[model samples]
Target: MKLTESNALARVAAYCSKAERCEYDVRKKLLGWELTEEEQQRIIERLRKEKFLDERRFVQSFVKDKIRFNKWGKAKISFELRKKKIPADIINECLGELDESELDESLRKILETKNKSIKAQNDYERKTKLIRFALSRGFSMDQVLKTLTGIIGNTDEEYF
Candidate 1:
């Protein structure tokens, strides 16, 4: 059904209320409805004024959900938030909420589980594969190396 301005506003408001929404997300939805630029801007302003849309809130929720449910590392989470057009300061602020020790522990768990499933010719190959896997999951090389060192008990091994 074609949505009138008022109806579109109501629908967008409901959509925003159902979850945290950034301005970009709301604007995209408005555009999908074929609203004019003026109408889109007005609706966006209304949503912001009514507290139905908040970029910071969206960032926080998005970060928390991705970390807790998806087990995503900071790098991956930051990349996804950037893709959503969240500001860098806001992304940093949201990412700051993640505890360092918790993140390390989570990475440790992931590596341990992955190590068990992987079969390689030698310890060198295994360590190399583990590092590659962690890196692919968006963890920094430094963190992955440190975590591997702690888990594997020797950093001197060439495969690190």
Candidate 2:
């Protein structure tokens, strides 16, 4: 397909209409289409002017979806957002809006479900596996430990 300014604008407008998109996402797509830097900038400005692009709205949707659907922790979601070139202030603000209790509950549920499936010879091994799993899921180590302790009961031996 031949890429032209008009076609690029049309295609990009359609893209943003379908889902929330950050400027980085749109810029990357334009880059892939080999649009000139000036063209990319113009289209971006047009999108913003038309209310088709809003960074705050995009961040809000991204954060909510990642937390509710993907069960992602702040660390993981923030990392992904950063990769997409979302500003730190926006990322921090959006993440801050999330309820801590809800996050902890989500983490707890994830760990509980994972604990059932893990096959370990001893409590130490089981706890170790659970911790690693939660951490890998973007949850903080402290959050994982606290949640794990609740599910598996407190032990005299520290399993870090």
Candidate that would win on TM-score: 2
Q: Say which candidate scores most in lDDT.
A: 2
Task: Report per-prediction Cα RMSD to one decimal.
Answer: 1.6, 1.3
lDDT of 2 by residue, 31-109 (tens): 8888999999999999999999999999999988887888889899999999999999999998999898988988998
lDDT of each: 0.86, 0.90
Q: Give the Å error, residue 36, model 2.
A: 0.7
Which ten-residue region of model 2 has the weakest summed lDDT? Answer: 151-160
Alpha-carbon runs more than 4 Å astray in model 2? 155-157
